[model samples]
Target: MRRTHSLRTRLAFGYGLFFAAVLVLMSAGVYWLVRQALLTEVSQELAAAAELIQQDFAASAGPLPGFFSDPDVLLKSLPPRLTELDTPAFYVQVSDLDDQFSIGSASLRGQQLPRTPEDQTAAMGGSTTTRIFPLGRGRVIQLSAPLLAGGAVVGVLQVAQSLRPVDQTLQVLLEGLAITGLIALVAAVRGGVWIVSRSLGPVNEITSTARQIFQAADLARRVPAASAADEIGALADTINAMLERLESLFTAQRRFVADVSHELRTPLTAMRGHLELLQRGVVRDAEDQAEMTADLLREVNRLTRMANDLLLLAQAEVGLQLRCAPVALDDLVLEVVRELRPLGEGVAMRPQLAEQVAISGDRDRIKQALINLVANAIQHSPVDGTVTVALDQDGESAYLRVRDEGQGIAPEDLSHVFERFYRADRARAQRTGGAGLGLAIVQWVAHAHGGEVLVESALGSGAAFIIRLPLSREQETEDRG
Candidate 1:
């Protein structure tokens, strides 16, 4: 198995790493700038001391021969500040061009200041130069300038300063930066972890809720509402909505299974009873045997019809594609009315086709939908009552309405009339009312043609089912033109 870390841990780590990098860069920059500034200050101080010595030499009478002849006079000619024995900051030295003779500051304590060949060459060339040389344990900055007499270079004067103080200052700064950076890094990491944990709290809750729902097999469980209207809240809302849909589907599935079992069991039981009677030689008379056989055949047909309806619904559920073509809506309605008139018994079917409309759809599916709606109306109508079928159109769509003179559906049941295996009159005889998939099939047909089916009814008045379908492409174009 691969190892994994929590989002909070990863986010906090990244945040801390970024902060540390920035902190390190900032500290390094400050250290470099301060080091440069301190070194520059030291160089300027050495240059000033060397300048004062050169000015003193220039002020003296006959500088080159007189100063070279007497080391004491030469040492005394330097700036008083540079010659201080107690001041350990600056060291001043004077040497000839070949470096054969030299005199140093009292602070040097008989030690000679070291001079490099490059500094000697530069000083002989009459160019002032500066260089750093390692001293006893620290370092020193040396500035060498030409000693001139009568506009001629004769020797070199070197001014140097110890770098111990600069080094000590930088070391202290480094230590402070390290300590401060460490403390800030630790605090930033802790604060980042806390912030990340707070941000992901909702995600943790969602995970826990989903886990519980999975283990318990409960689709009705929902993720808790988020406190803030953020992306997490939107996610929770979406998941809750999906759960609600799944729960509805699961409930419907269970109900469908139970309804199918009951519907199948009734016909199967009737057939079995009739078969048992015949086998026992109970119906000996020819007429009685024929009637029993007809009854058995009726039950078998009912079962077959129920099976076919279930098959159609299954096909629709699995996204069955329709063979679409231009269908004459008025003609199809008339055909369905004529075919189901006998099934109406004493109820009359009156098709008030006010308009001849054409639509694009699967003719067979549309015919089946029409038959189901008309038959359903005929079934629910009172004896000798009228079942009115109307065909009409507006600018963009055609409408097929079927109205029955019977007890209207209750307001609560209207919303669910088109659900599979749902019947308002649950106690109605199965043989007469069927398995209640008719309205569902009608709804599927209407939706498949980019249309919708609607119901208008109230208790005890009557019921009207209207299927609205878009006009055929050619008809719509002609009308628009």
Candidate 2:
């Protein structure tokens, strides 16, 4: 198995590594600059010393041969600082044109400084050269220049200085940089961890809340809000909204199951009672037996209707597909009104329709929707009241309205009238043998046909349910043109 590190650890480690790389590069650059500056200073001093020695040699001796002829006189011409027995400033050496050692500074203590062939050749060519090489217990910077007599190269003057002081300064700087970098790296890693953890704190809280909800099977719980409105906060808000929707859906599902069970139980109980009465021969008269059989048939038909309505609702919830064809809206309205007029009993049914209003939709589904609306309106109409079915059209859409003279829906119940199995008056709905799914089916049919259903009602007044469906494309085009 591959091991994974936490985001906080990864971020902190990355931050520390980046800082370390920058620190190392900066330290290396600083060390290089300082070392170069010190070496340049020493080289400058060596050049100056060599120049002064040459001037003294030219002043004290008349010619190059005479200068090399006497070692004691040459020694006397050297700088006093170079001759000091206690901690001399520099080591000096002189060599003749033949590459023979001629004289040396007292600081050398009779010790001859080693000369490289390169330095000797440069001196012979009259080109001054400087180099740094290891000596005794430390290092030194040496400058070699040609000695001139009568403007001719006669000998070589070499000057060198110890680099112990510069080394000590650089060593201290390296130690300081190392210690400071280590401390800063540690601080940076810790700070990065803290910042990353704080930023992801809300994510952890949301995860914990979701875990609890899953374990407890409770969708009511929500993720806590974050302190700041950043990306994490937005995520928290989104999760809470999802939880709210899930809770609503779950609540509706439970209610739908209960409503379906009750609706089924009522018919089943009545049918069973009637079947037992007939089976026991309690209805000896043919008329009584026939009535009991009719009651059982009625219950069965009600159950079948409820089952079909439930199936239609299920299809609507998944996504209902319609068979498209040109449908005459006025003719469909008139047919539905004629079929349902007898069911209204004492209530009058009226059809106020416009002419030549057609739509593109499934004919059967449109008729079913019109039938549901007219039936619902007739069921709700008062005794001897009028149930008006009206159809009208505009440039883009057709309107089908079903109005009934009855006690209108309350303000609070109007919004939820199209919800499955919802009834404002449960007792009245039961007395009428309604499953309370008619309005829902009507709403779904309207939506499937690219339309919407709206209701307008007030207390003690009648209610008007209007369905608005888009007109057929060809009809709309012709009208527009």
Candidate 3:
């Protein structure tokens, strides 16, 4: 089975890995530079030793007749120890032009020094050549110089040094780099884990808060905002905002369920009571039976209307599917006002319509919205109150305003008037209007048409609800079609 790591583990591991990679690269660079510096110092020492040996050979041969002309004399004069003291293990050898070794260090005596093309070239041209190679259990560097007799090369002198000390130094540096890198990697992993854990602390709290909310089924629970203005803080704030919305929705849902049950129960209880009376033969005459039937029909009609309103509200909540077409604003408003004239009773309705003003929207839905507003206005109006339905336009938008001389909405209820099943005066609304879904439907219709509904009202004064919709560009085409 594969193991999956949490976000914290992944973050820390990634950070530590990156840090370790950088440290390894730096350590490798340092090791390379140290190795180069050690090799350079070794080369410089070899050069100095070669120079000293050449000088001594020149000094010892001056009184004698060109001592390099004799390999035996040259061999006897060469010093075994090239440096003063404290120099590392050293080797020296003299070879004739024919590649036969004559003398060497004690460790290399009777052993033939390795010959190379560079040695022949150095003997012929009187130049020095240096090379490095592996020797017994370690490495060595050899510097070859030509011996000269009256400007003619006689033999070659080669000096070599064991690289054991340099090897030992570099080995120590490698060990140090490995040890230090390991320590740094461990420190980086721990530090990364701590920092990551600290940074995600608020996120962990958010997770815990969410879990608690889910377990308790409480939408009101919120995570405390982090103090720092960082991503974590932003996340916390966002979660809190979401929780607030969730709480509002849950509260609204509970209220809606209670309201629907009460509304339905009232009509059902009335129907059941009337049915029981009819079953018990309480209606004795035709007139009494007719009155009972009318009362039952009215209750049934209320139920039917409630069911329709609920269905429409549910559809609007999901999304209102509008049958889009060009609708003449003035004519549609006047038509809705005429249909609601009977419901207005003693209220007066006046139309202030502009000529040829049109919009692109669902005609039926728009008319329904106007009807609801008109009915609401009529219901709230006093006897002989004037209800005005006006249609006008600006350059970009058309407006439909419904004003009524009625006791206007309370300030606190104005914001919630468009919420489903919300009623400022439940008793009055139930008596005269619907199940409190009319205003919500009106708001939905306005929004579906890319318009908005705005209401201005104060208690004991009149109220005006204005529907603002953008004008259609293809009005002429729609009219012609």
Candidate 4:
């Protein structure tokens, strides 16, 4: 379904409607003001004309005789002078009280205006008044005033002006206003659309870029960033950041898969070779068969260890499931030191255990991390050199520091020590039969406990790996309690 209007259309329509309404109201107000002014001027002019006509009748005929008593005298004398005074814009009329006798401008000579309610009201001693009525293909403003003689009204005088010219003027004004309003409305709509389009252009670009990337199945593609400090710019930046993260994640995933495949294939290849040899009966004797079986078992164990390490790392990546408890840092460090001391061979295991050092964490994970660090130290330390396992605490944190006296990590390899399967030296890696995931696991365990593993070393100077964890609040509370 064509569910809704586009944003541009909606914006333009709403803006245009608002502008049009404002223009209409403005035009209406202007038209009303102009009409009022024109009509008021016409009424005032008509009043003045009516006054002058009464004066002309009273001066010219009232003194000569029965002008006040006879209606015919005032009617006859009024039209000629009124006609001479009349211009094309306005006309005059005189009528008796009975409304039967009337005389007016030449246009009204044969045409008789009706005795409207306003005219009768004027004749009945009301104040002077004005009214509008249609007359002969046009409209007129009619003002009625009483014609008085000896303090009594004998007749009514009306002055009317055709409103054609004024109406034409108003019509022209209306047309101009309408034209201007239309122009303004069009301009406003166009301008609003243009502005809205420009403002939304970035969002459109993001959408287009997203569609392109989705179609191409390319995580590396990104929306172009904008410098504008607007919401659109922010959205673009956010999308770009998301794309970057996705690209990084996918790249890492691919590399991880390749690495795992290569690593697992080695053991699988060895096991297959030995199995095929056994199937082909290539073993020369019982000793050879036993040796081959031992080799196969070794490969199997290696594969199993690698698989287990990968599982742990994968779980850590998502969020390691750790069983939490309060563990003594000093006790864990001493325990790891004791377990690793017998395996050190020519290397000496040293302990610098601090008292009452504790933390809240998974004890087994913490112990595993400590063992990994000490084992790594044992592997790296030179003959007769000391591998020191130390535990201490400051105000807010507990720390376990393991230092190995050996050729330390090179500067270039130091940063990558905790990366999966990263070996500082390949020869040592082969000699030690270590998978290089020990430090990585240690780092993971530290982070899982909301702590961090920090390393400091220099070539030939030895390396120190520090596991820092938050102090156990329970320990403090128990002591206080």
Strongest candidate by lDDT? 1
lDDT, candidate 4, residue 201? 83
For model 4, residues 1-481, the per-residue Cα lDDT tens digits are 7789888789889988898899999999999999999988888878887787777666555544556356666656663567676676576777777776776677574676666776678667747878788988899888888876545676787878889989999999999998998898889899999998998788788889999999999987789888888888888888889889999888878877776787778778888999999999988799999999998888777777777878888888887688987787777777777777789999988899667777878998888888888888898888999999888877677889999998998999988899877888877875666777788899988888788999999998999999989888976665556
TM-score of each: 0.73, 0.69, 0.77, 0.66
**Residue 288 error for model 3, in Å?**
4.2
Candidates 1 and 3 compared: the better one by TM-score is 3
C-alpha RMSD for every candidate: 5.5, 6.3, 5.1, 7.0
Stretches of candidate 4 off by over 4 Å are 17-179, 278-291, 476-481
Model 2: lDDT of residue 1: 100
Which ranges of candidate 1 are over 4 A from the true structure?
28-171, 196-209, 218-224, 231-239, 354-356, 427-433
lDDT of each: 0.87, 0.85, 0.83, 0.81
Could you give candidate 3's per-residue lDDT for residues 1-481 as a string of tens digits?
9999899999998998899889989989999999889878877877787777767765555445535467677656665444352233777776667774466666664554586987788667977887888877779888888865445566787778888988899899999999989998999899999999999888888999899999999887788899999898999999889999989988999999998998898888888998898999987788988888998998889888888988998988888689998898888877888888988889998999866788888999989889989988998899999999998877678889999999899999999999888888888976863788889889988999899999999999989999998889876454446
Q: What C-alpha lDDT does candidate 4 achieve relative to the native structure?
A: 0.81
Candidate 2 residue 91 C-alpha distance from true site, Å = 17
TM-score of 2: 0.69
Which residue runs of candidate 2 sit more than 4 Å off their true CA positions?
A: 14-181
- Total clashes for model 3: 0
Worst ten-residue run, lDDT, model 3?
79-88
